[model samples]
Target: MKYQKVLIVLLTICFTGWVSLSCHTNESGGGELNDGLIGYWKLDGDGIDYSGNNLHAELIRSRKRPDSGSTNDTEHNDAWHQVSASSNLKMDDDFSISVWIDALSPDRDVSGDIISQYDVGRRKGFHLSLTTNPSPTGVGNSRRLSFGMDNNIASEWMDCGRPGQALLAFGLAEYNGDLYASTCEPEAGGAGHVYRYDSENNTWKDCGAPDRSNTVFALTEYKGALYAATGKYRVAGSSLPESENTQIGGRIFRYEGAENWVECGQLPGVEAIMGLVVYQGELYASSLYSPGLFKYEADNTWTRCSTPDGKRIQSFGVYDGHLFATSYDLGHVYRFDGTEWVDCDQVGQNNTQTYGFSVYQGELYVSSWPSGKVYAYEDIKQWRDVGRLGEELEVMGLIVYNGQLLGGTLPMAEAYRYQGDTTWQRMDQLDTTENVKYRRAWTMTEHAGRVYCSTLPSGHIYAYKAGETVAWRKSFPEGWHHVVVSKSANKLSLYVGGELVDQKSIPTSDSYHLSSGSPFNIGFGQHDVFQGRIKELRMYNRVLTKHQIDVLGSPD
Candidate 1:
């Protein structure tokens, strides 16, 4: 009888150990590290959660097919997988997401979301994606992998002081992790000098004027160097008083450090350089008053490229494998294919100019003048109205920040965030200078983790740190790359290819209760629809340790 009792106890102990081992063992080789794993999608052929959990995701197409040139492929544009909201998928505490991505059409002008479960209306949840938008504080190689969270609160704007006696902070750029601004100072003997922002002291350090021009019109980064374009801006164009300085300016200069710039030659027959961008691997510039687009060559030479409908192009952006240019003539957006230009036609019936471009929620969006409204690109020449900024005449800077699309407006100099379905929420009036005919929140850029906006009349820069974002400030490499986003305790960390790349601290008051009832998106979110292939997606209800993450990121 004693032997029988002992044998029964031993059998029970063995069975309990076997069950525990089965629960902890991961088929992917992370032994005893599968605790709190809620979902695991291999995405080999379908969205089946192979972790013995029945959280299957449904693939859905969010946009209608084009009337012509449809491929009818299963993974077409706007196609993404959706997992229904469930209690287990609701990350109300610590969580981790790991996935592998292979971007298909990676362009310098485009960005797309990888995975997210964010609600733009309520302003809550988390988002992870690739970002390539321009910010005021940082300049070159702006493409990065960004992970952000919405804390259900908007940050107040911080004043970064004005840059000398400048009337307008005409342009902003980020270069080598530093923030620089170009100004428009039309006073006699006051040229438009480039100033670097001193964050530690809340001041501006003059980097000297590149030319005897009223405005340092544009800034860009190419080949690991900072470049500035000059312009003789006429303040009377904005209904402001005419300047005493009238020097002709269409010069380009390369930064050689503090208070020094090297001339890179000037554009012939061009009085002002309106825009500058680095497309593909070359530098391109546009003329403000002439119908010309010039490409930089070796040894201070520039070759003029074919113009779109002989129209003047003012601002430039890249998307969908083509270089897109906004027109200063007919409110048209054009696409360039190196040899020729294809006009996308006018954006709105009444608007006469398109100012800037931004990517939001898997689509291209542009801001317009006269109407002061924003429009989303539906197809070639097809635009959907996205409402107008309140009582504003022109919208200039369009950028994506903190999982939301934001635009800066003229006249009122206000900023607004896009909610869903043509709704916009006013954020703040950046410039409060009164008795001015036009106050502009002119240019913007992102640096460090904050969105900075430069204002006209005041020339003061305002910064907003919305939520928390950690960005890998380099171009996402080609082929497949491993990415991990982990929110543990009060810290959020990003790991790329099994190495820690960037991190940011969550507010102590943040509960991080990401219980937004929105569906978990796999290849789409609040940004452009993902233009890539995703596989081996895993979500854990608990934070993943570095060792466990490294093992998963390793090759088989």
Candidate 2:
């Protein structure tokens, strides 16, 4: 229930619910093909491209998360990075290339190119991939399906397997010509099945679900057909309370072609419908425990429109033409002005929370929560904040790669790259974990020049293209060393003067996550305190082992 595949990886929206991030478009891209989207890259370790058309891609051997990259060190694959450069690239057919493949060793079978645009002798394009279908004990990968696609030159490869409890492919769509995905199994009673790959009989079907919600998360396309969105039903590890998150409420289905599909209703008892948008022409949907934004109109019907129920609308965007969003409730950011949804005022304060939504050149950018910053917006009200990824980071998805903006962060599942509109640049680290149990870096893609991310628990796959060498950091030990820190309720520790250095497992909140109930006083907050003074101090509510602070001698 902890993952970080693709490049900025990071997933575990509180475990149990399997692989996360339901679409994401810019609103940055949750896949309905971001128009001329081009080589987006979100891999941050830089492969260039930024979509301006430079088309970068190249990193073959990647590494980052070295020194304190410590996630208890299960570390095996060594390190990887390779944002493709060219198999000709330039793609079209409506585009649609999603990534975030962190699958270290479900026993192995495939996975090396998170977003490949093949030439295969001209059969050409497509490769959003992952593997694990062979078994006898050699490869069943928890159960199966780790996200698949290869039609064109790879001969034929249309995967959509995730069985053994499930967790793969959070979002990707090309509609009708085939290529729709949005799963996340986690051993439940149903909600996880949106496969469909047939890019010309390459095969793979399923294409169903969403009555009691097996977990469809999201799958775009809008005005013509393909439109999915549902919630609740995970069961694998567990986490349901939002009054059951959905008794069949927040749904939305449409497809109707091969395996059929239908439904298109829901949103009354509402508990989770995450995000979806088609803008001006039609289709809307978004919510989380009754938040707001529902439109659709005919067929199964829908109406609400604006927002106000409880607030939770996580992501959405569309610049210049209008409709912008971001809200984990208080982190606000609104903008829909043709009639309602105003408030462009919040960014991170009440517990942080606003989430990733992208729009580069035309403005709009989000991804919030205390130290993991990333604001931008512009008119209706203003909001800049810009740059961040440390004070306990938590950015989850965004894309505009190659020409700028690229983000994804959560408990260290890094990936940044904005260099301008407000500054940002790291790019890789799906693996080196400080481990806050790795939660939500969900999805942010850009196929062709490579740039994909789909992380959750360690399900890795990072690529950012073009010659590299960065990864070094983890040095420490310079001089004036006399530090000590500790925490409990699952653990966290560190020391320098008395030795010990580092420790892990704080699972979900602690280590003085800084809200300040007070007392650890030195110079007192602000400059980070104790530049030189502090003759003595001690505070112990509990958790002080190491022989109880080493017999307390140093304080003398």
Output the number of the lDDT-best candidate.
Answer: 1
Number of the top candidate by TM-score? 1
Candidate 2 lDDT, tens digit per residue, 259-338? 57788687776655767765555667777555677778886778876564446565665443456667766677776744
Which 10 consecutive residues of model 1 have the lowest summed lDDT? 67-76
Give candidate 2's root-mean-square deviation (CA, Å). 26.0
Query: Would you estimate the TM-scores of all the predictions?
Result: 0.88, 0.27
